[model samples]
Target: MRRKQDKNIENKQREEETIPKKISYAEILELKKPDERKLFLRKTFLLIGLILFVLSIILFVFINTLVGLGLFLLSIWVISKYWTLQDHLLRESVYFHPKYQEFRETPTKKIQFFNFSFSRFIATVIMISLIIWNINTFGLELGHVGDTGHWWNLGALTWAYPLAIPLAILSLGLVGYIVIHPNLTIIYESENLYHIYEIRLFSPWLTEIPKNNIEAIRLHNSKNGPQWLYAVILFYIILLFKSGIALIEHPFQTNYIHSVHLIITASLTLLSIIILIAKQHCYFEIVTSDRLYEMWFDPALLHKRKMENIANFFCIEPIARDQHGFFDPLPKKSVNYDDQTRELLISTSRSYFRLCFGLFLIFIGIYSIFSYSLLGEFTAYTCLSYGFIVFFKGIKEDFSDKNNIIIEIDRENKQFKQKRIFSRILEYHFFNNLKSLQLHENTDKSPQYYPPKLDIFDIAGVIAIIFFIVQEYVYQIMVWAPKNIDFQNILVMLFELSIIITLIYLIIRPVDTINVGTKTIDNYIIQLPSLFRYSEKNGERNNFILSNVYKSKETKSFIKKRIILIIITISISAIIAVIDIFQFLP
Candidate 1:
């Protein structure tokens, strides 16, 4: 009877909810108004082209070759603007429709396939630069070094001719790619679906993923760095470019160290280029149960609003589930003095994967120091530091004794004495704490069962960032001055080391938890401890742990007030920022 009554209540509530208007097919296909800012940008671009063309002509007439070459870049910029404007118009026509959600379009929502991202532009520039370098280095020798020509006496250089020929051919191919790269950005979109064309100017082209086929959308941190191999590739590329330039400028005067550097650089650069050609950026992954589709995007484009818009059209939803089945509260395993009970000491054992990685890093560091490779030293220090942290985390969980957390039920004193691992002394608390255990619903973007503990995760993340900065600085110093150490460098190294120590302390610190009220003294009378005291008053003893998840009334109230103030401050700041940006825009 109660279940039936609840069903009736739910049905009534559903009926009372506001109904969305039924969308028609025609309405779904209808376009909305053009964005005012985009329209203004379109006109401004056209005006700039006219001005630049006239300016280019004047410069060509006044100055000779140097300034005339600038026109080529100016023309590309003008054409790129027209392409961008075309994309903005397409988005306005299809995406802005109010009823477009009814069409169920999949993501990739391509405005233009030919549209260039910042990374793409950077890649194109790198390719062009490399082609020029190759030409300067090997082009002339391979083209004219034959037995019948004035280069007939250059037969002594014949040993390198075979290798140079293939190298020159590869350079020519790279140049050809740049010429054709611009043509790949085709626009493909409709009211129902849209997709970006996967173009490979320097990298492998991704296969097209149809909108109707995608079963789910996965989000990633836009700021996450590229793969470790890719990072190594970038580092080597820099080294190669520097050495190659030095060789080209003064081939005969270069030292043995410079020669070795050039050879190593060239080999690494070739390997890196091959990797770049084979690897595609694994950004937004469109997942079906059976397959995955990966694509990269500008970080600014992956806004929450845009993601939600995509989700609405695709008829897809974010995956969130209680996969761990922690719905019921259970006591975590208690640690004891005996090593025989180590297996039951903690609910979960922290994996040693990171610790192993750290050890590998230490090996790399030792090798680097022996080889006098500064970059290797940086990698070693950073990795070893992180490795020891996770190693100790495992150690603490494995070896922690009962004294790590002491929960004393003092019946005569009508108090509880709680001592956690990191605390200097025990905290004395009166019994009479109230409220039942409460667990907040946790949802993460990744496929995780539980929310991460923010304290540890947040600190580790900050340390990683600091180490990255330190690593970069160390690399810079090694390149500029191998032996000299500046005061600033010493300070940075110290700071980096200090963070490692802090990480070790945090990782090994015993986690203290209880299953009672997180309330203050005022709400203590209404808490579960107060109810437990009733049994104590009747000459019975019950020992229990409290859940430390809830905030006290006073704390919650204070936090609420502060949050309101912060929201208002942020609102005012955002409005001011927007106005300032608009004022500077033409």
Candidate 2:
């Protein structure tokens, strides 16, 4: 009886433990499946907001101002509720119990200063201050005259205020959301011989692979990070300058002092440029065996490379410094690398190119503003010539990859086929019998696959070609044709026709190449060939094979040609401008 009683107690305890475990597992599952209740609440609020906004507009048109104002306020409340609910849903989705596991294992000592709670608090405070200032200045404009001690007699405020205020609020919210959201961080645990992917919103996933899987691991400067700040600043300055110019031309007949505005605008632009340059230099990447890790102006880059008994690798640190003031220097920075090689240092070269292009565009805009007719004619001719050059170059490179090895993999049948290609029209079949095709590389020994012949006078191209051909004809007709046709009228019609044709062709031309893939009905069968490459045995001549199409030097040469063509086009335009100016001289 004692033994039975002890067994029963043990069973009861086990049952109690199992019940909680099952309940906890169920809760986790529910969390994983997206919170539908929050979504539904958000949808309800959105619908209510939309209805209120529409009703407010109708009430404003038919009823009194008080009813319209009340409805508008109600709409705003509904919209705010919708946004709050949506944000709550995102937070719930991104912050689950499982996600905290990653932080638990990572050493607290390695955490960067910027990643701390204090840094986030400071950023949030600054953002909030900016928001408050913007609202005080712009939100007051939404109210009626004397509503907020501001008098504005713009009748468009009824619609504009509602739309613009919400847009501004949404924009600010999006920026905050992006800043707060955690990004996926991949860490190389050399000791484990595996890659650790700490997904920002989820538990870490680990993948183990042989050393051969890693092609190279190197610390290179992030192309996007530093330049993004400058791009944003430049874009903002350009917009502001354009706005200021417009305002100066058509002075806003308001109480605001125009002189004060001009001074403010100039100061803002100067400050923005300086801040933009400062931010550009503080970005670097911490590359690992499997993925590129961007470590932005962080101290992690300064740490010495550590190699453990388990994972042995070298680190390559790629650094770029500003010399000769070609462009703004990125903030002084370095990042630790583990078993990686730096491929190239590109900061200075890319900056120089970007600066030159921007200045060229600005010069063109200025010239166009001053001498519209001459610049217009020269621009038209230059664009036409460049388009033809690109079309021919694309064809030439496409035809160059003819003889190379093609490896086609059939996933379904677990079979692979290797073939030597001699022509551009070669085809391969996957083991699952799906038609897998690729263009082989062009080589010296094989005939190249020429691009499909495009009709030189295809509808739009015909129009462009005819426009230039008939321009002289139109000029002649104006002098020799019937009295009913006015000379200037004919010339104008010809110009308009040419412009329309050129615009249509420019709009329709494919800016980049297209890739095609084939899948079986079951979706289990998939096949594709590896990239094309030149065969050493083929006398080093280039031909186009499906696999080697993009890897060829011909492709690089083509890109170089396009760039050179652009330079030549610009030079030609300048020369034409000089000639035109000389003709116009008294």
Candidate 3:
């Protein structure tokens, strides 16, 4: 009798442990009633649109150049009204599956979204053909630039062709990768494991996250919601400044016919800005403890109701959080850790990758700005502005808030990973935001304004940059003097210098442990950063080294793989940029 009772109790406990925290959908999903504020907004937009339309007509009869500005404002108002109405309708009722009425525990549920659109297919075909055509064109150009031809008299043409070949090849390679890549794949298994694969075309490579290592599954909106706003502001500021200058200089003497084109251009630019702002809110992300999976919506595809419906059907919990958006219906953790391990403060190695890349971009931008080509100046300005923004952001993070630290422990691999203090926001649009998840010691004190410490790798990078600049300066001076200078010695010296710097950096920045004296701390509230990190003390009575023995080989292997990938990417970009902007013939 006693044995049977004990078995029953054990089974009940296991069942309880398996069950997720129950949440009522009705309680969370509120049917928003028609409010006065919404009504006011609707009316206000309609009024503005009407007024703008009337004003545009008046302007068209008088100052034709001003008509376009009026029309653009009217169009914006109309679009805003449409969006507001759409949102209101979507909030009226919860669009949910009948299955959601009763939560059923399924062994596995997989949602695969394959975005093979007709337009994308057409684009891929065009790109492939263009690449082939360019490759052929480049070969001809290269032949023309040979000693037999007057390539020197061609000046910029000579340099442009040589630069074009590599750029074309790089583009072709990237396009091919994108065309073959899968859109998005999500698989949720009974073992609390999520298998997610998200591949976008512009991304250099596909990321296949290792299975069963997810500590937490969350869905959130991206943090880059404001960067788009900044871009729009800059666009308008430039536009207004140009328009004001033109008006002052020309006045009534402004040619109405010629100004029509300018108006059209301005109108299109405004429309684009609106679209850009709208698109910023279109992203929904599924963040694992380690990996982040993001998907962009057309806004037309799934309304708020439909999105929630999909979430509910998939057993996802809907969450509304500030800073970043997280979805609901979190899966139960596959592996459970002791309470003590969870309490450990974690930190990751501070990789100055973003800083270095930003500096490289600024350098390129400066070069382009000075190159004195119209197109170069415009492109350079954009790059310089963005570089400054990123550079400042890195500084802010390093100085102020270090919000991206999280405690990530992989029981399967017996490895712990954490992002650095000043990690870049993972929410990326153009390129893949891959962070090297390396574990490091966690500081016991609160985030402090510590003096900047230059790492060995940073010094190496600076030295390389100095060498390149010095070599370029010398070569340029020689070229301007109309003298034939042999660059073979300089090239060899630069190559040797680079090799030595790289070796020194590697030797100094080895995978060895550091012994910064440790201290014992009593129980304190631990808040995780936006990203992942896990720290374990190296001393005695360190009850913190989470339940499992740290396997150095596994951790080192993981770190090495990520480091190699980053190095390869940086090297390729640097090579292409250097070739593209070769200023002197030496």
The lDDT values for all models are: 0.38, 0.36, 0.38
- Model 3 scores worst on lDDT over the 10 consecutive residues at 515-524
Ranking by TM-score: 2, 3, 1
Cand. 2 TM to true fold: 0.34
Q: Which stretches of candidate 2 lie over 4 Å from their true place?
A: 1-131, 138-153, 158-188, 191-212, 225-239, 243-314, 317-354, 363-586
lDDT of 2 by residue, 426-469 (tens): 22222223333223323433222222223332323334434443
**What's the true lDDT of residue 109 in model 2?**
19
Best-matching candidate per TM-score: 2
lDDT of 3 by residue, 339-397 (tens): 22222222233445346655655665556554543223444455444444445334433
Measured on C-alpha atoms, candidate 3 has an lDDT of 0.38
What is the RMSD of candidate 2?
Answer: 16.8
Candidate 1 lDDT over residue span 88-150, tens digit each:
222322222223333234333344323233343444455445445544444444444543221
